[model samples]
Target: MAIELKDLAPLLLKAERTNGDVDPSVLTNVLRGGRVANDRRKELLQVIERHPVLSDRDMMYRNHDERYNFGIKKAFHYIKLLQEGGYTDPVDQQILYSAMGEPTAIEVHRSMFVPTLENQGDDKQRAKWLPLAKNYKILGAYAQTELGHGSNVQV
Candidate 1:
């Protein structure tokens, strides 16, 4: 599978990175921020990989609605697995989102909702809303693209 590197990637990345410097695990740990972070990421990836539902394979042949709905199912199981495994950090949540490959329907929760609360909402507001947001109780979407400058989507 790696045969399509086109020779430029090796030069750009250098042979040392591919086969020298330090152990690959060590490099992965360092790149992932630390040992604990690396282990958590590995655990999450393993959880995704071992399960058939979480795999991204065979998605090419499915219809849009099929894929979308399957992705939603996967997202639900994805969170359940992580939470059940004792993961609480928001950073760990990115593992499932990363595997999603593109912007899914739940993109707003991660991109806009969390940032909006963290940046603007006071502690009381966050305390009341963040749990629901975190647990997917209130799935929000950024619908700004659907609203023109004059439109009032608030209602």
Candidate 2:
């Protein structure tokens, strides 16, 4: 099944809990890729000093429009850095997405399917089982409903 944005919101909250909100220093590192020298740090601050706020979508949009494109640009920058750093495997991408909460759907896939396979499938079974998951050949969902033997959902 295709994933929906509504289905992924909780995972984003979980991600913030799991990874903390995005760090300003991490953005600096993404731009410069090393410890900022004293002069560079001042320059960075000077750049921000003129703006009342910082935004994540500066790469894609004409200006800082947070709602539509924050994750898009941030994910773009992240994937570029990861490719530069030579971690190109799909599993590596999954892990990075799980850690950083972007490309919007990978975290939902991980939170739903990864542990489900590990806990609900057998050992040799899981080896064969996980390939589909890693490749997006299979899709999964996490549902809470007021039905069956499970507890109720208010909504």
**Number of clashes found in candidate 2:** 0
Report the number of clashing residue pairs per model. 0, 0
**What TM-score do all the candidates reach, one by one?**
0.69, 0.35
Give the worst 10-residue stretch by lDDT in candidate 2. 48-57
Residue 95 deviation, candidate 1, in Å? 2.2
Instruction: List the global CA lDDT of all models.
Output: 0.74, 0.55
RMSD after CA superposition, every candidate = 6.1, 17.1
- Residue range 35-67, candidate 2, lDDT tens digits: 554344455344333332232323344554563
Q: Tell me the lDDT of model 1 at 31.
A: 90
lDDT of 1 by residue, 12-118 (tens): 67865777668878888899899998887877777667777766666678899998887677777666766677666777778866765555566777789878877
For model 1, give the 10-residue run with minimal summed lDDT: 96-105
